[model samples]
Target: RALNVILVLQCERRRFLRVGLAVPLLGTVAELREMVAREGHIPPEQVMGGMGGTGKGRDPLRATEVPSAVPQVILAEVSPQGFLRSLGDSEELGAAGEGAPLYAFQPPPARRPGTANPSPLAGNRGLHSLDWLGGQGLPASPGAAQPEAQHPLPSAARSSDCLHRGASSRVLLLLCNTVSDGHRLTRFGPPLVLREERGISWEQLQQSILGQLRALLRAEARAQGMGVPLFRIRLAEGMEPCTYLSPQDPHPLCHPAIDRALQLSGSGGPPHVRLMAEWDLNTKERLFGSVQGEAVEDAESVGLQQQAHRQQPSCTLDECFQLYTKEEQVRGTAG
Candidate 1:
């Protein structure tokens, strides 16, 4: 549950050079600005913008972008990948892009139990192909029925839940490349369905997603190979990102939104692995259908993950059972 806010400082936009920073995402707006100023040596006045890609403006950061006296830097909240993709080259930053990732304010997480620091998950195995993620996309057939996506139900128990209707949920995987600056590439993979007929497996979904994602974000993604790329699954009104961390480590402290998501997913509601990937598709033909990398085999399925999650001490999913309905709460209060 590593929680961090990624910000791209568009210093001198004309030069197309930005310094990306990863800060703790939990602080308040004023606190964050103060923190950034103290740490980055830039006063809060220099930090001007606060934006979230979430359409409805439900983003936590958007609420804090109140008008102020200083030249507030437009501090936009983007994924680490997006921020990295925003940074173009080492020559641009004058430093080797330590893993081509955004620089983080938090110390890196500890590696899996036995591994040394700086080791990539599963031996840093890169995903081999993008074919399974919808077959390089079929030529548009005139009458082909476009896939339907299912909106997720709330975490609370409800008689009208989507799962009760016996329909599978679909999600759009989005991958975006901002390094091109003027000519950015944003690709959407075929919709992935969350089906109940087959046993659910978050592990499999995650691998399939990472396979396609790594495919798009390869070292060769950029002809210049310097910009960072990112992908996420777009839900109805928000974007969910695929989480990366050490294999042996427990999930980074889940964010409140994610904690809610876990509860909803484990509650027999619609569950999806966010698979939004941003990459340059124009020159990715070489990667299309090319399956040649190692993939981790998972014996446990998503159903298993849910069950194990339920068994954990003080798991939020289990805590859902403790919640009382409004009527029940009223009656208890009256009694």
Candidate 2:
């Protein structure tokens, strides 16, 4: 069976590597960790070192006691709600669920009290500490206070530069409400502007979109007195022709299509972008019914509603926010 694993780095939790491996169902989690280490080109020692646990209930000074070998990389099952349930080393891969998503998190180093944490940029200190002007024969005085070093860039300017860099990394995603009428595809409502910054993995993006849909779906289902249906989000490149972002694609976030779209937006192209979303069959059916209701009514006369069925296509992203707020209010009042 093919196993999908998300490798989380200890230093940078936001950026992760998503990898697929072909392994036997009977294989153990220990074996799985080894495979992940090999696939990612990470050291096996780092994946499963002698040290383990959450650094609790262990004696540090006990020389006579032997430390049991524990996997340094934590293997856990991520729930739809974003909670993690760690898997045991001896646990069978099949028990975790066939083709289920798994996360391999590299644990940060344990820190004890009274010990200082080292800076991540310590290696770069050599560049700053070196005195290039020492050969100029400037005599150093003993027991004299040194002058305060001046920085090339002021602190405020540096901070602003960082801020601008972050802003530049933001991707404006126009989330178009997409659905099918059993024959033809139709997209209604104003596309929502989803601002995604850099350093987020494709899996993280999928989860975020799914979480938003869950809340909206629940609120709508409650408002309509119907069952909440299961759904999935299929990301697409543009509005027309539906160039799908395949789940099998290793780098969906950094795809060439997305790059082209971003480039177009950066230029003097259309201010608005429309990205299509593919829904499951059940969600499509539910949405089609809602669309029928919208066709028969005047959207402006209806005012703000808990179930805004995308009747007003000309509405802006602000109106979409209002719709979500209205739904939240309905859900709150109902509860």
Candidate 3:
């Protein structure tokens, strides 16, 4: 009978261990942020924004606009058992009888040769643990349903813990382009015009661009068998325009924003490639005219060489060899 009781208790402990192991789904907000920053090659400061609210507000018209700080990411700890129990009324644990065995089993009489025996009832020492277990098999308490009605249980739990922890469970980031007071109109366009420059809407533009970029990134990742999610893009509120027109000769025709964007993209790869494409689009005129000019020059040189070869009349062997030597010297000098 005692051996049977011990076996039953061990089985119960094993069941609880399994449940505990499976209870939590863990992830850190910091880890996610770091991953995004590294993959995007974005500076941490750009993503987090400035330290204080010193900059102009996201809204252009607000009188006392405060610079927005990065929003925090939230992590929720969900209790599956608690959630299930909240679905309906739950039964309570039975009351303990006076002088009754607090636990159901006793330790074995002998210890094994190389192993130590665990104290019986050690598992039941904590009153809370015992209470939890005692009520485990019973129906959930009536109060369980109250939480389900108030709000989304997961969100509520995350918020409550987030507040108590003094950290936001939800994450937000910001990216901005610096603009000077002087260049605002020339580089960025007229402030009034920009403010009124409505068409597809900023939100729609952001969504469209982000969607396309994410799709491309996903396809590439899939091809490479990578598991990481693609980086996400969000528009920072309040765009400030800056002009980059030549200081010597300001052309109303020159676009500063496109120039600044091109400068940021640097010399190689996708950003440079994209910049050239955008430059061509913005310029409308043949921006590759210089390249065409270089090609034309090369063609003229080739034509001159071919014409000279054809025009040359037959000559004596000594004269021919002397002419070849003279041509080689001229070529070396040109080269």
Clash number by candidate, in order: 22, 0, 14
Cα deviation at 330, candidate 2, in Å, is: 77
Full ranking by TM-score:
2, 1, 3
How are the candidates ranked when ordered by lDDT, highest leading?
2, 1, 3
Q: What is the lDDT of residue 317 in candidate 2?
A: 90
Q: In model 2, what are the clashing residue pairs, if there are any?
A: none
Worst 10 residues of 3 by lDDT: 189-198
Best by TM-score: 2
Looking at candidate 1, the ten consecutive residues that score lowest on lDDT are 191-200
Model 2 agreement with the true structure over 213-312: per-residue lDDT tens digits: 3323434442332111122233342235434443333234444456555554321111222355544446655534443211121223123332243354
Q: All candidates' TM-scores?
A: 0.20, 0.30, 0.13
The TM-score, computed over Cα atoms with residue i paired to residue i, of candidate 2 is: 0.30
Segments in model 1 whose C-alpha atoms lie over 4 Å from true places: 1-185, 193-206, 210-255, 262-275, 280-286, 289-335
The CA lDDT of each predicted structure is 0.29, 0.41, 0.21
Tens digits of per-residue lDDT for model 3, 1-335:
00000010112221100000011123323333233233223332223222335543343454453434221111111121100010000111221111121111111112234643332223321111112122111112333333223222111011111123212111111111112233331111100001001112222222222222222233332233111111121111112431222212211112233323423432111111011001121221211111110000122333444555557477899997887776434445555
Please provide, for model 1 over 1-335, each residue's C-alpha lDDT reduced to its tens digit, 9 standing for 90 to 100.
11122232322210112232333334333343344344444443322343443332446645544322331222222333332222211122222233342221211111224543321123332211223233122122244232122112123222122332321222212222222224653233222222111111222233444343443444553233211112222222143443332111122112233333333321111122222333333334433333222222222232454554457455475466566333344445555
